[model samples]
Each structure stands twice: as structure tokens, then as C-alpha cells.
Target: MPCAAARACPSFLDKSIHPHVLRHSCAMSLLQAGIDTTVIALWLGHAGVRSTDAYVHADMTIKEKALALNTPVTAQPGHYQPTDKALAFLDRL
Candidate 1:
């Protein structure tokens, strides 16, 4: 957290900070900045980009944005299809 404190405000992070916390924060920041995971992995000195996958998938908010972009514009919201088993149970009820 010393790295973050030096670069920004020490009050930015409330929890106890460890040295490795900065590495994680840096990786997440890179992801938010739209840097490719592969590049981040290389920057972090990882042997393979696969090691950086955790950071790539860690943020649900990012995933939601990506999903939103991929969704068909023609598709309307709030239309959920129940599974076949659920449909059968509902019929019995």
C-alpha cells in the first residue's frame, strides 16, 4: 500500500495494505484501462498470460459491461425462459 500511498492518497485504501496488494491493484487498474490481459501478464513478469486470467475475470462489473455490448440490440430485456424441468414442475402445481 506504500506504493499507492506514494502515488496517491494514503486514505484511498482503508484496509491494511501489504506490498503484494499494490501488485493486485495495479493489475486491476490495467484491466480497467482496457489493457489486454496478455500484456498485463508480461508486464507483471508472469511466464504466461493465463496467470493473469484471474484479474481479467475478477470484476463482475466489467463482465456485465462486456455482456451488455454483446447482447443483440433487437433483444428486449426481462424475458426469461424457464428450464424444461421447471416448466414441468409448474404444470404439476
Candidate 2:
């Protein structure tokens, strides 16, 4: 049966991809593009957000990028030295 299906869809056989694998790849692609998990779940016809969480958990690239984005600004360089006038205002306060 699988062989017949593969013959019917040559691209699938050429890529050696299964339908569920393709769906997972598509879902992961969408997640990497910053689309919300809720939207991904709906797009993939998942019953709940939990179903989509597996894709996110399995993709370290997306997780790494998201973690980088959430990193505190203080971790970066450049001290916040105020101008003379600004310092004076702070002193007044």
C-alpha cells in the first residue's frame, strides 16, 4: 500500500518523506518564522496547544533564537552616563 502511494506521489518517494514527517516539517518551519504556537496548532489541526509543543521542544534553533531575544539589555555594553544637564536634574530631584 505504501509503495503504491509512493508511486502515485513521486515527489514523496524522491524526497523519502512521509505525510506526518512533512506535516511536522511544515509546522517547525512556521514556528521558526515566529508564528504563535496556537496558530500552528490550528494550522496543523491539533486538538490543543500541547500537540504543538513537541515541535517547539524538538527544534533547538528556534529555542536558541527565542532565548537570545529574551536576554536582558543589561548584558550588552555601554554604560548609561547622563549629560551634565540631566545629572543636574537628577541632583535636584
Candidate 3:
């Protein structure tokens, strides 16, 4: 069949392209292009970053590259100790 011949091309071999698959492909391509997750989420009409996080979290290479680019902070991590007077003032607010 002429249609079958067209499908024989490896690029067009997958005939089961679902809408979600197309959405995922577009999101992944945008992510790989260094677009921000917030912008991608907005473009995809996601309600929040939680939805877009799946695309970012799914790709380990991006995570590794981000980690590699960050300089480690030497400052000690600790909770802020508010004085009793400051605590009382915040409580009033």
C-alpha cells in the first residue's frame, strides 16, 4: 500500500503517537533548549511548577550539569534564632 510504504520510513514508523506523547516531546525539546520550567509550564498551561517538575526531574543529565556548575557554599547552615522580643513582636503581627 502507498500508505504502508510511507509508514516504512523509520521516522514515521511509530503510528501510535498520542497527544500526550507530542506534548511530552515538545516539553522535553524546550527543556533541552534551556528554557525555564516556569515558562514551559505556562506554555503548556500547567497550573503550577509541580507538573513541569516531572520533565526536569526525569532528565538526570540536566541535574548533573546544574550540580557541576554550582559552587559549594562554605557557610554553616542553621536556623535563625529570633530573640524573645522579636518573637513577641511577630506574634502581635
Candidate 4:
């Protein structure tokens, strides 16, 4: 059914999807499944993790959701309000 739709409307395939599009889709799917962005960038042959940001730029909402899911849980929630100890540690560096 999907192939038929693709055939009917080339635009549906986004003007003939290239192998890179398939690669991008695979990368995005892996990312959606909780895979690390750095790993995805490596798998997709990106020069750097920053290159992978392009795929994410198209969808900020999804990016936010991914970040929310992946963020580490702390004892307290809200934002990371650094403690005095943390401030001192940062000051040292």
C-alpha cells in the first residue's frame, strides 16, 4: 500500500527519495527509539554530532520530548540549581 502511494505521487516520496533519505529515516527512527544522538551521528556518517542537529532542526517538539526522556533524574526537579559545593567546584576550574 505504501509503495503504491509512493508510485501514485512521487512528491509523496519527496520527489524520489534517495538512499540518503532512507538513511536519514533510519537514523531518525533510531533516535526516536531512545538511541543517543552521538551514536546516530556516527551511524549516519556525520562529520560531527553537530551535523546530526540538522535532522532535529526540522522538529523542535520532538527534540524537546527526546531531551525530556533522556535527561537524568535528580533528587530534586525544576532546573539544575547548583549547590554551594557545585559552585565552588566550578570556581576551581
TM-score of each: 0.65, 0.59, 0.61, 0.49
Candidate 2 residue lDDT tens string, 1-93: 457777788665667666899898899899888899999999989999999989889999986787777879867644457899999999999
Cα lDDT of model 1 by residue, 1-93, tens digit:
366565587665666778789999999999999899989999999999899989977988788778888889888865479999999999999
- Give the winner by lDDT: 1
**Local accuracy of candidate 3 as per-residue lDDT tens digits, 1-93:** 435645677556556667899999999999988999999999999999889999998988798678666736864444358999999999999
Worst 10 residues of 1 by lDDT: 1-10
User: How do the residues 1-93 of candidate 4 rate in per-residue lDDT, one tens digit apiece?
Assistant: 468868787578666777888998997788777687899988878889998887677666686686788777864445557899999999999
Off by over 4 Å in 2: 1-15, 74-93
Write out the backbone clash pairs for model 3.
Answer: none
Q: Considering lDDT, which of the candidate structures 2 and 4 is the better prediction for this target?
A: 2
Error of 4 at 56 (Å): 2.1
Q: Which scores greater on lDDT, model 2 or model 3?
A: 2
For residue 61, what is the lDDT in candidate 4?
63
| Candidate 4 wrongly placed segments (more than 4 Å) | 1-15, 64-93
Displacement of the residue 84 alpha carbon in candidate 4, Å? 46
Candidate 3 backbone overlaps, count: 0
lDDT of 2: 0.85
Residue 43's lDDT within candidate 4 is: 88
Q: What RMSD does each model have against the real structure?
A: 5.7, 13.5, 12.4, 9.9
Give the per-residue Cα lDDT of candidate 2 at 52.
92
